[model samples]
Target chain A: MPMNPSLLDNPKSDRIRRVADLANAKARRRSGRVLVEGPQSVREAVAHVPDAVSDLYVLSESEGADTEERSPTLAAIVDRAEQCDSIYIHRASEAVMHRISPNAQGIAAVVDMGALTSEESQVAWSDTPTIAAFWQVRDPGNAGAVIRAADAAGCDAVIFVDDCVDRFNPKVVRSTAGSLFHIPVLTMGADEMLAWCSAHGIAVVAADIYGTPGNAPRTLPDMLADRVAVGQSKAVLFGNEARGLPRQLLERVDRIVTIPIYGKAESLNLATSAAVMLFSLAMSSHMGRM
Target chain B: MPMNPSLLDNPKSDRIRRVADLANAKARRRSGRVLVEGPQSVREAVAHVPDAVSDLYVLSESEGADTEERSPTLAAIVDRAEQCDSIYIHRASEAVMHRISPNAQGIAAVVDMGALTSEESQVAWSDTPTIAAFWQVRDPGNAGAVIRAADAAGCDAVIFVDDCVDRFNPKVVRSTAGSLFHIPVLTMGADEMLAWCSAHGIAVVAADIYGTPGNAPRTLPDMLADRVAVGQSKAVLFGNEARGLPRQLLERVDRIVTIPIYGKAESLNLATSAAVMLFSLAMSSHMGRM
Candidate 1:
C-alpha cells in the first residue's frame, strides 16, 4: 500500500532545510544524497534507477493550482512512483516545494548519490566499446550537453577526466535533460583515464584543432575514410572550453582528429564539435561505408 | 589619415546613450543601426563589413586594467578599423563600455543595419546550393548558434521564414561568433520562402522527427543513402524549439527527414540537432560515401 497523501506544509522545518541544502556540494557530501528537480528528471530517475531513490516531494494542488489534486502530469508521475515500494512519497505545499527547488515543475526527488557513482560498480567491457571522455571541462551546461551528446551517439560510457564539473550539480543534471540516468558517467584523472582505456584495448582519439608539433591532426572526414579506424574500439577525448588539451595529454593519445570548418567561422564550440564528431563516427561505423 | 584617438569617457553622454540604445529593436529601427559586441564580432565587422561600421568604442585600460593604451587584442581590432577610413574610434571608460554592452569583452561598435539586411542584396542561385531555414525561432542564442552551424556546414544562405527572432539582436550577434558576417541571412514570409525556393528549383527538406499522418519521416541515414537526393539543391527547414512544424507546413515540404536516436536521450536540442544534420549531409555530399 502507498503512504497517505499528507501535505508537507512547513517550509522551514528541519527536514525541509536539509532537503534544500543538498543543492550545495558541502551539503551533498555530508548527506551522501543528491537532489533531482523537475518532472522529467524525477520521472527518469524513478524509471531507470528506482532503487536509488529514497524520497519524492510533489506539489499539492491546493497550494499551486485550482483543483484539489496535483496537475495531470504530476499526478501521472506520482502514480508511477507509487509502484516502487521503496520510494517514500510526500505532497509539498508551494512554499515548501519552491524552497526545495525553484526549477521543480511541481515534482522533485532525493536520490542516493552513492547509487549513481560508478566507483562501486564493476567495470564491464563490451567487445568493441565506444567511449566519450572529457579533459578539464569546467562549465556545467557544457558538461551536461556533452554527456547528452555522448549518450545520443551510442557511447558505452562517459568519462570525466581531470578537473571537471560534478555530474550531480543541479545545473548539470538539469541541462542533461534526463541523460544523466541513461548512461554510465565516470570521473577519473587524466593518467587514470589513459591507463584504463589502454587496459581495455580502447584507442584514445584526441579531438583537437591543432595537434602537437610532432603529430599533426587529420580532418574528421579523412578519419572517417579509414574504415578500419572507424570500426576500432575507441574513446574520443574532448578538451576544456578555453585552454583546450594540454600538450602532454595530446602527445599521449594514440590518434588526433579535427573537424573541418568549411566556412569563415573560426571553429565550433566544444559541445557542437563533440556531437558532430561522435555522431558522424557512429553513423559511419554502423552503416559500414555507406 | 586616421581620426584622432579621442576619449569618450562620459558614460551618460547622449552619444553614449544612443549607441547603447541600439540594444532595443525600436531604437535600432529608428536609427537604422545595430550594436556589435566583443572582440570576435567587432573584429569580424571591421574585417568583413567595414563600410557598415560607423564608430568603435573600446574600453580604456585605466578603467579596467593597468595599461593606458588598449590591450594587444583590442589594439589589433582598432588598427583594422583605422583602415576603413570612415569609422570613428573612441576610447571609453569601463563604465561607458559596460553601458554600451555588458558582454563586450572591452570593445563594441555601431554598424548601419541597412547595410546588413539582405533585402537590398541580390540573391544568386548556385548549381546545388544548400539553405538553412527556420520558422518561429524565438531564442536569440539558438538563432545565433543555428546561423553559425549553417555557416560551418558551407550553406549558401540562411532564411528566417515566418515570424522569428531578429538576427541583429545583440545576443544573437554575439552568439554567432562572427558567422553573422560570414553568410547572407534573409527573412521572409512562409509563402514567400516557398515561392522563392520553387522558383530556384530547390527542394524543401523538413528536419523534423514526426511527419504528418499521411507522411512518415525517413531516418537521416536512409536519406543520406540516396546519392541523388544528397546531391540535390535543397533547403533544410528546422521548426520552432517546442512546437515543431505545423501540419500544414510539414505537408508542403518535398521530404521529411529525421535524425535517429541511438541511446535513451529523449531528443537533441535545437543547436546540436542542427549541427549534426548539417555537418553529416555536408560531409556526405563532399566525400560521395562514408
Candidate 2:
C-alpha cells in the first residue's frame, strides 16, 4: 500500500479522463472496472471484496501537491486497503479527487467489475433461505435501496430479473451505502428467475398490490402469520417503481402479497415497500409465532 | 365550475411572478400561500383541504397561448378543483407553468399557507391510537416520505417536533405523493410534544439504534410481541436523519426501541426505517397477537 508520490493535479489527463468516464455504462463495460466513491463505499469494497479493488485514490492535504491524506476518514480507508495486499494506493489533489467523483468525499476506489459482474455459483442453502428479487426495477436509487434492505433482512442473495438497472451504476453503488459489497447481486431473465427458484425448491412470492384476475393478493400480515410459509425457503420478488408487476409475471409467482395501506396513502414507493415486506417476513421467521 | 376564458400567457406578469415566488419561504410567509406542484398533490389538496386552495393553474394545450388542459391527468385535477367553489381556476401556457414549478406536470396550485401552518386541536383517541413524530428532520424529501409512511401506517397524526422542514415546502409536498393531505400534520417544540403525549396518556417510544446508558434498546419484534404496548395509545418518535436522537431526548422518552439489522448491512435511512417501524407496529396492532 505504498502511496504513489505523483500528484494527480491535471483533471484533463488521460488517466483522470478514464476514471471520470467510469460514470458512464459504456466506459465501465469497455474498461471492465468501476469507480466506487465515498469513504463508506470504498472501505466496503476494499474490505469485503478485496480481490475486486485494484486502485485506491485519496485526496491530498494540499490543493495541487500530493502530501498526506487530507482527512482521518480517508487515511483510515488507505490503512484498511493496505491489509488487503492487492489494492494500489494513490494520492491526488482536491481538484483531481473532485473530478473523479463529486460524491467521493475525498476517497475513491477503482474495482474490477469482473468480480462484480458474474453471477455467484449455486450453493446449498439453509433450511429456510430468504432471497430478494426485483423485476424491471429501473431506478438506480430504488434498486440500490432495495438491495440494501434485502441485505439488512438477511437475504441469501438478490436477483435482478429482466430489464433492471445495472448494479454497477455509481448512483446505485452510492445509495447502497456499502451493502453492495456484503451480498451477491445477480441478474437473470424472468423465466430464468422462475426456473432457478423452482430448481432450488424456493417459493416465489410476488410483492404486488394487485394480483391478476382470480388471483387476489394477500395482505403481508396474513402471509407473515402463516408459520409454514414464513419458515419455508422462499424468494420475495418486488415490482417496478411505478408500473408494478405485469399480469404475466404475477401469474407465475407462487403467492401475491401486499403491504396493506391501513390509512389513506394510495401506495408505498418501491423502496419503502420492499423494506417493510422483506423485514416483516425476516423478523417473523426469526422470531417464530411471536 | 365554469372555466375562465382569459388565457394567462405571460410568465412575467405580476400575478405569475407572485405565484412562482411561493417557492421561497420568505415569499410564502409574506403572501401567506404555497405553490403545490404536479397533479397528485393538486388533486389531493382540492379533495381533502379545499378551503386552503385559492387558485388552480393548469398547463394549456398550446405552447404560448393558454388553451384547454393538455392531459387527462391535469384535466382530472382541474375538474376536482372545480368542485371546490372557492378555488379560482386559471389556464396557463407551458412556459408559465414551468416558471411556477419545474416539476409541475401540467398543473400547479396556490394554496393559502394559513390552513397549513397551525397545529391541529387535541382530539379523543382510539383505544390503540398510534402517532408518528419526528425530531429535527431537516431533509425535505425524507420529511415528506415519512409523512406518507405514517399515513400508510394509519397513524393518527404526524408531529414535526423541534426544528423540522416546513410542511409546505414544494419538494416535501411533492415527495409525499398526496399523503400530506391524507393525515393531520402538526408542529410543536420538544417540550410541547412531550407534554402533549403525557396529557393524552400516550407512551413515548423512541426509535433509536443506540439507547442511552442504562437504557438499552429493545428490538422491534420483541416490542411488537408485547400486546399491552401494541394496544395502548402510543407515540413513536424518530430522531434526526444523521445525528439521531440526543442522549437528553432519549432519557425523557418512555422506551427506546430499535429495528434489528440481521445482515452485514449497517443501517437503514430515515425514510426506510420510519416505513418499516411504523408499518410493523401498525400491522401488529391491527391484527392483535397473530
Off by over 4 Å in 1: A1-6, A63-70, A120-126, B1-6, B63-69, B120-125
lDDT of 2: 0.87
TM-score of chain B of each: 0.96, 0.95
| lDDT for position A144 in model 2 | 91
Could you give candidate 2's per-residue lDDT for residues B1-290 as a string of tens digits?
55576778899999999999888988989998988898888888888889889998887775433434357777777777777788898877878998898999888889888776645663334567899999999999999999999999999899999999988899999999888888888899999999999988889999999998879999999998999877888999999998999899899999999999988898999999999999999999888865
Interface DockQ per candidate: 0.77, 0.85
- The C-alpha local distance difference test score for the whole of candidate 1 amounts to 0.88
User: How many clashing residue pairs are found in candidate 1?
Assistant: 0
Candidate 1 per-residue lDDT, tens place, B145-210, comes to 999999898888999989999899999999999989888999988989998899888999999998
Error of 1 at B148 (Å): 0.5
Using Cα atoms with residue i matched to residue i, what is each candidate's TM-score against the true structure? 0.95, 0.96
- DockQ, model 2, C-alpha based: 0.85
* Residue A126 accuracy (lDDT) in model 1: 54
- Considering every candidate listed, which one attains the maximal TM-score? 2
DockQ of structure 1: 0.77
